[model samples]
Target: MAETVANHILARLREWGVEQVFAYPGDGINGLVAAFGESDNQPRFVQSRHEEMSAFEAVGYAKFSGQVGVCMATSGPGAIHLLNGLYDAKLDHVPVVAVVGQTARSAMGGSYQQEVDLQSLFKDVASEYLVEVNVPEQLPNALDRAIRTALVRRAPTALIIPADLQEEEYSPPEHVFKQVPSSPPAELRSTAVPPEAEIARAAEVLNAGTKVAILVGQGARGAAEEVRQVAEVTGAGVAKALLGKDVLADDLPYVTGSIGLLGTRPSYELMRDCDTLLIVGSSFPYTQFLPDFGQARAVQIDLDPGLIGMRYPTEVNLLGDTRGTLAALLPRLTRKDDRSWRETVEKNVTRWWETVEHQAMLDAKPVNPMRIVWELSQRIPENAIVTSDSGSAANWYARDLRIRGDIRGSLSGNLATMGPGVPYAIGAKFAHPDRPVVALVGDGAMQMNGMAELLTISRYYRLWSDPRCVICVFHNNDLNQVTWELRAMGGEPKFEESQALPEVSYADFAAGIGLDAVTVDHPDQLGPAWERALNADRPAVLDVRCDPEVPPIPPHATWEQMKATAQSVLKGDPNAWHLMVQGAKTKAQELRRGR
Candidate 1:
């Protein structure tokens, strides 16, 4: 049998050392699906419950593995379903390659079944690179460029393959005038660094300030030691962007937790008091949480010239690899003799944790949501990989959980989309099958898509060397994050029709699928439940009934926001009294700890 385009595409993927491709089946890709069996599955085809989950799983795999992730889909609807997750990859700057099937060339202009203009559809999300492979000669070059562009640019790319062409005989590009050939698979390496003069100027800004603050993002993941060295010499306090939550251990006395709306009080204070700022590899968008403009001299170091100096005003913008630039900047900086600023920052961090602990122990109607993450933080393994969905659960994951040791974590950072939490854990499992993984999700997200992915887990969990994968669901029958946003941001009462969720027993569903499961209603049961799930023989689900009225108030809530909440209550919110009581109790913990 002669080779076909579908066979050659898989061969190219194997040459690039891809281990798996997350995808779902359809008639449009029947050629490729058949090729998978013929190839002996060299690069395993990890089937997903839906096309959206396939894209999300690819994002998660890329995030954890530090390699380009690949996802595949059929034409029209399958291609359309990949947009949200592809946008998540684009916004978060994760590298992913999407391989999609299109209608046969014969039926394309005739408006055949599942026919869609995939090029116009994917133009924006895969703006970095997008192409349609017309002939077998286009195979190696097109697929290779897609992978290389995704790796070099850290963005999503796409390749559209017509259904009929995939089953046709393969042909190599000739060494003639119009034909183009690609080089063998290899990673491009470069070390970009700023000039010494600019590095010196940045050093001067840091050395001159009495109170220095450093902000790190996911871009700083590889330069942790350099960040710490710079902080120690400059007497700077470190604040992490949400995406960089695992870059530095919270155990460091000078490391303030996540900064922004889902942020720590100490982080807010760190920005308010600093005289100078150094932003490394972070494009944290909320500028209001940063130092007041013109009040502080700032310097920024980043690998991408496009993103550097855009988030904050900087005296010097060093466009270089974070690890290399920070390593270069270290020698130019002079140590601050006085350590008073560092001492103050550390003191504030200590008090903030105490307040967090106190708040987590507070009483709610059935159970406090913060306690779910707090208990997990206590028992999480040193090498665990944790993922959180976007909702009220993100608040506790940001504030209550402490990241330490070699633990890795991520979510839909820039997009802040829901439903990736569960699939992310599955991707993490494939990336590091020997390590334990956890997903913290809300009921709204679980119902949206998390439950179906559980079947995917049941099929694959036994393949993992370590079988601990826990999905902890915050089972409050409400769209809790938007409910709070309506009151705080829109000054509107909680509209039950849109805000309330229908209750579902996630534990019962998981148990029905032959996985370990538990439901916790009391605060005391949280610890034991987490322990059992984490130590289970297979993947587990934890469904805890949380209080819907508990407010996720921001640490630096403005008077206007407070006024809006008050107005919403007065305007007839259903749980006005319970809201006031829970808010008071939660806030009292911080006030008492401060005193």
Candidate 2:
């Protein structure tokens, strides 16, 4: 039998060592679907419930696996559905290759069913590389380039295969005019190091300052040891950007948890008080959260030269691999004999954790959302991988969850999109089948898509060596994050029509699908509920009835923000009294445990 372009594409993927391709089926992709069966699913077809979930699962797999994630969808609506998740990958800088089907070539301009201008559709999202395979000969080179470009740029790339072209007889790029050939599959590796002169100057800036603060991001994942060594030598406090929450263990004395709005007090203070800043592999936006310009000398090291020094006014920009740049900078840095600043930072971190614990234990309508994460933190496996969805749940995951040991964690960091929480956990499970994966999601997100993905878990859990995938849903009957945002940022009362969420029993849904399930309406039930979910022989859902009014106040909440909240309360917010009481109690913890 002659190999079709679809068969050849799968062969190429296998050659590139792609174990699974997250996808959904449609007639436009019938050729590839048929190829999957003919090839005996060599590169497994991991069917997701939706095209968007497929893209997100790929992003999750790529993020956790440190490899390029691939997702597939059919033309038009299926292709359009992939945009959000692809944008999530692009913004968060995850390497993902989106292989999407297109309408038949003859029918493309005729506006046939499911026919859409895919090239223009994918242009912005897959800006690094976007190609439409017009012939069977274009398959290998185009697909290969998509994967390579995605890995090299750490962004989403795309290949649009027309329906007719996919079923055509496979033909290699001929050794003739206009033919482009690609080399065999292999990851290109390089360790870029900044020039010695720049490294020396960066060191001089560090040595001259009495206080140093280090910020790490996902780019620093490979440089954890170097970051730790540099921090030790410079007597610096390390603050993690949310995306880099798992870059360094939270147990580290000077590792001030996440920075920016969802940041710890110690992290905010670290930036406010530091005389010098070393940003390692983090392009953390929110320059206001960084040290005041001209108040501190700064050095930034990043793999992408384009991102270097863009976030802050860095005196030295080292465009190199974070691990290598830090390695070069470490030796030049003199040990700070004045460890007073380091001591202060560590003390602040300690007090912040204490305050976090107190806040998590504070009274609420039912379960404190913070306590849900706090309980998980206490019992989460040393080798677990955790993901969080954006919302009030993220606030608790950021503050209350303590990342330690081999535990990995991430969320929709740059995009801050909802619905990736459960999908990311599923991807993490596929990436590391031996490890337990947990997702902290809000009720809004669960209702949006997380619940449907539970069936995906149910289908795949038996294949995993460790069947401990937990989706912990914060079951507050409101879009709590935006509700608070309206009060704190917009000075508007919670407009119940838009903010309220229709309540649904997530645990019941999970149980119906033949997975472990538990619900926690009280703080006392949280720890036990987490235990059951984490130890379940299959995937489990923890539907926690968290307090909707428990505010996710920033550690360094501005006076204007507080004023706005007050104004909203005065204007008659639905849960004004509960919001005030919860906010007061939560803030009191920080005050009582002051550094």
Best model per lDDT:
1
- TM-score per model over all chains: 0.99, 0.99
lDDT of 1 at 295: 80
Residue-level lDDT of model 1, residues 1-595, one tens digit each, is: 9999999999999999898999998877888988999999868999999999999999999999999899999989999999999999999999999999999988988978899999999999999999999888886999999999999899999999999999999999989887789999997654799999998999999999999999999999999999999999999999999999999999999999999999999999999999999999999999999999998899999888889899888999998989999999998889999999999999999999999888888899799998888889999999999999999989988888899999999989999999999999999999999999999999999999999999999999998999999999999999999999999998899999998888789999999999999999999999999999988999999999989887787879899999999999999999999999999999888888877
Per residue, candidate 2 scores C-alpha lDDT tens digits across 89-196 of 999999999998999998878969988889899999999999999988786889899998889899999999898888999989999999989899997665999899
> How much does each candidate deviate from the true structure in C-alpha RMSD?
0.8, 0.8
